[model samples]
Target: MPSKRVRYPFQVLALCLSAWGLAWAGPPAEKDKAPDAASIRRGKYLATIGVCEACHTPPAVPAVPGGGDPDRERLFRMDPDWVRYLDPQRQLAGGVPFILRLSGTTHGLVVTPNLTPDVETGLGSWTEDEIVEVLRTARRKDGRVLFTFPPHSFYNHMALEDARSLARYLKSLPPIRNPIQPRTLPFEPQPMVADGPARAPQGRTRERATYLMGALVGCRECHSHHENGTLVEFAGGSPSDPFQGSFRLGPDLPLRQLEKGFAAFPYPGFAVLYGSNLTVLGHGGALERVPTERIVRAIRQGIDVREDEYGRPRPIAHVMMWQFYKDMADVDALALADYLKTLTPVANPVGVRLKLFGTDWEAAFQQTYGEPPTPEDRAAFGMP
Candidate 1:
């Protein structure tokens, strides 16, 4: 004998609203709001400087009628056509595979995902907060951790505003219907915390440069020395003292030994490349010897024009990500160069085995340096 429950009129109204998928949550959070025009523009600028398109956009085939495969290569590449351009239709619709290698071992390939706003295939369902979280933590909501390819480590503590703007820009893109496969890791990705609090850059030029190189552009990922595994926080470094250089692909031998000479690298024909010392500490450091104009040229042109022992400019190895920086604005590139002159010096002499230009690199190199290397020049660099 239970009294019949009496529902209030308000409760009935609430039930009706819930049934209609219109439950009142007061108001949508700021993160859920549609971005304004200024916000979208700022986001686009940030994405361009971050070179998101370099890794996210698939390449276009010049000869193909309709077009070629979308996911053929990762990063920018020189096709048989010798001209490289991102497919406008598939912009940021990532489907390329980035091979993950350690020392000489191949772990697996990490496929880039569609960043467009496609409801089913891309990030359309993701909230701005979710996108910001991935930028700040390198860990997605699904628990998958991104390593290296995205350089999320450097982006982990970027200014909150900049990160949010970047997210807004990504969400504003036209929805592309590319579906990306999930990545399988050879080892578990460890959870990461920022080395320090997330601090916004001050108005000073060096501070802005710090935020630009360390966070947005990720110059430190390759230039700084790392301890533990490749996924750990950079060791013995701070924002102002990045660029200490690493031995991962460097010649570990002393200067004299390197001069006395060593055999060709273990990987026959492959260049032994390393992040060169950009600080003003060692004999090989760029700050002391290289002019700021030269640094700007290197950043914009990809050729280290600092004459080698052979009295010729060296074409930086492809791994340097110079292609991404080629389009950087002059003011920012100059700021980065000027800032490098003020770094706390760290003595790390790097031995970079320059790569010989191949037929594939012919047109691209010509476009950059005005012409391809002469036959004698190729033989001088040990290319057959």
Candidate 2:
């Protein structure tokens, strides 16, 4: 027999490597389970991270019990008591409107749709698999491609089980009869990606990120500015790429402003609000230079990101949806960061910090919100 060190250690090392290799070998394909309580629970969690309520929820509704099924008659009557609950049981019944913009020009206005099981106004007519297919393709029940939903991309990349969970949860909701206004599209609906919805290859470093961030997490949607229905820029690329001017920041932005972590995003209700330029060419230096722990906080909490010259904390823009993403798995967030690092840089420098609000971002956030998350408060939020 070989020496003990050579025999035992090498054998163990080989075994460990084999196990590690299989981790990224891609998920074993399988059929999904039937919808159940457990699925609803999982879907509820994923939907929260997906920020379903952010777009789907209307501005306000009365807080009341979700008594009786909110069927067609209840919706028609518009009963206050039938509508409200803490978990937004009245949610996904879509009536929220969003202002679509590209380079300060009005693209169109679209309304959120009711996702309830209402026979007339909601998904009651749809089959579960149909919903999943629509989600995966960005094509609606009628084959129309949904253009503006950033989370749609994220949802499309979810595993079958997770995607099913979300669908099951939506079906579990009380189907209220809220007929939402349809989207006003400039072009006919089509698949989001060039080659259509293809799953990532079995094993590759960027495969998951390419699938998730490109379409799933909606990173590409926020970071790149497109022209004539094509993505022409990537926000995280090097500064010298030819596609620099293709961002939504418009071609008029100054380079210096980008250095200060400013970029423009024309929000639905607000004027063009600025966001961070997430490129290696120039960054807030918060994500690039900070420790991994702080980076996680920035992505999860959105606080302690910016600082005044005195190193005091400043506020980040709410446009990026850090609140909804706070629940993202630490692993996923890290994977996103790592994949982002591998992207080719674009020279698109973007900024107009707080132009829409006519106030400092920090002051606005401070006035409206409480403190950033602390590790001590983890238990309350379910962290270990």
Candidate that would win on lDDT: 1
Candidate 1 segments whose C-alpha is farther than 4 A from its true place: 1-28, 31-34, 61-83, 102-106, 147-150, 194-199, 202-204, 225-269, 280-290, 303-317, 326-331, 344-352, 355-384
User: Model 1: which residue pairs collide?
Assistant: none
Give the alpha-carbon lDDT of every model: 0.51, 0.45
Worst 10 residues of 1 by lDDT: 8-17
lDDT of 1: 0.51
After best superposition, candidate 1 residue 321: deviation in angstroms? Answer: 3.6
Cα distance off (Å), candidate 1, residue 209? 2.1
User: Candidate 1 residues 62-149, lDDT tens each?
Assistant: 2232244544421122221111455778888876544332212223445568999998889998888788778887777678777543
Error of 2 at 238 (Å): 14
Candidate 1 lDDT for residue 303: 76
Give one digit per residue, the lDDT tens place, for model 2 in 173-198.
78888777676644554564333243
lDDT of 2 at 297: 69
